[model samples]
Target: MSSRSMLLALAAVLLQTPALTQAFQDDLLQQCGTTTVFSNHRQGRLRQSGVSRVVGGIPSPEGSSPWMVSLQLLHPGMGYVGHICGGVLIHQSWVVTAAHCIKNEKYALPISHLWSVQFGPELKRFAIKEIVIHEMFAGYNHDIALVQLSNPAPYVPVCLPKSGQGFQGIRCVASGWSTTSAAPTTLTRRMGIPGPRAHVHLSVVSSSVCRNRYLSAYNITLNAGHLCAAGKGLLTSGTCLGDSGGPLQCNMADGRWYLAGITAFGSGCGRPGYPDVYTRLAYYLPWIKVQIKKHESAEKSGNYL
Candidate 1:
């Protein structure tokens, strides 16, 4: 072929690359939001009669929450990483978490190298390649972050919400792994097997109702990016576990669990009558997509922050 013809062919291929990539990305996510291990019977029973085991929740089942990711920090003295927060797997190599989990507090940077994510029922670990914090994040204003794992985890990812999916009054479950039953007390940590995890039941509260609750109780106004959720049980108790960045998942009518939000923050490790806050995933899905697309190649290329 002539040089001009060859150049035209190359340009055509280049123009199609992004569209092809997008198609593949969509296909991959299409296979997500499900796991062969999730039992419909077990979840039904739990929903019917789940007792307050950890504060106002019960321990998670082994096959449950296949997309839950435990964020761990390396302990300099202990020489091992332990669960510090929680995250939800959105894609094979991407996780969604609360920005406050790794926010820069003069102690830990948002893009710190010490952070990693542990997932799967076997509890395998993966190194964090890149962290994308919301650019407008400031004191929980935009309290969500996207995490890029160094390699794709061979695990099923939780489904993102359909465009404009509303979550108010929806009964959801928030799952998190912790060493103790309540606020961190003297407890021995475990490894190489399933650790104690809590599956707290919560009901999504409307933004206005949540705002009023916070204002009347704490005398503070909340950001619109946050989701307010009241705890499940008598009197609608809030979560007391205090595991940040955990998933606030709701089981949709299709018998599939969709990731609604991540644990953002709560005052005093949560208490009765108040609703807990979460980084509404639906509100920030666009930001999440842009960050993930922009950084999808970062893991394979040169170093980036």
Candidate 2:
């Protein structure tokens, strides 16, 4: 079997393990403190328009999306060259990403395996203090995780949606270091083939429409926690292999940008009928708050402060 297939099969078996299931259940149900309320910490606006004009996407301006980051894993012989996924800075010390980014198919990898988080256009790397993956995360459902920076990043965080905020028809942009090429399907073929940085403008598709499309074609059912978005122009364009766990950001009418989604998965890169799926931020807001609070409390207690 292919490595990807092997991993998926292993994940299925591990998910059924009683001890693992119980541990995850206990963590999922753990109570959290209520002191710190969740809110976005905006710094200021940039002179450049949030929109990018390049076909794929030009190298992002210095501070355009300061919250964007690259998560890397160090292999025994490869060092930090392996770029596992992308992430967003939700707070000075907190990052949000897909849980699968930090885990293999069978188990959550050790913290030592995580090398660093590269932030901003300069791509300064920072050590990680802690990682908190949602306990209930099973495969694609609840596909979210948080990373705490050993030292706080100086960049301003992107705002999160207010409770119940609607995203339908909103124009959101997806950014990553993935290839700009349009045809490659496998990761190896697209490896290191860099063009302009990827920043594709996409429109949010309604959940019902996205669900129906996936159901009809792939027999997959999408839940409310998933956001579906398609490319804006005639030419097919969206995220690919290296873009997992990156942000799907939307600029609101108030001129503030909010993190609306995290790129999760897709049928193929920029296929005409298949919209890329993201882990909807609003749906997971409560869980996010609880986890952050729990971690913050632990730090205060010197668990890794």
- Per-model lDDT: 0.65, 0.64
Candidate 2: count of backbone clashes, pairs at least 3 residues apart or interchain? 0
Worst 10 residues of 1 by lDDT: 44-53
Error of 1 at 246 (Å): 0.5
For candidate 1, list the clashing residue pairs, or say none.
Answer: none
CA lDDT for candidate 1: 0.65
Error (Å) of candidate 2 at residue 241 is 5.2
Candidate 1 total steric clashes: 0
Q: Write the per-residue lDDT of candidate 1 for residues 89-125, one digit (tens) a residue.
A: 8997798887776775634555545567777655466
Question: Residue 3 error for model 1, in Å?
Answer: 61
Q: What's the distance in Å from true for residue 222, model 2? A: 0.9
- Score candidate 2 by TM-score against the native: 0.73
- How much is the lDDT of residue 192 in candidate 1? 19
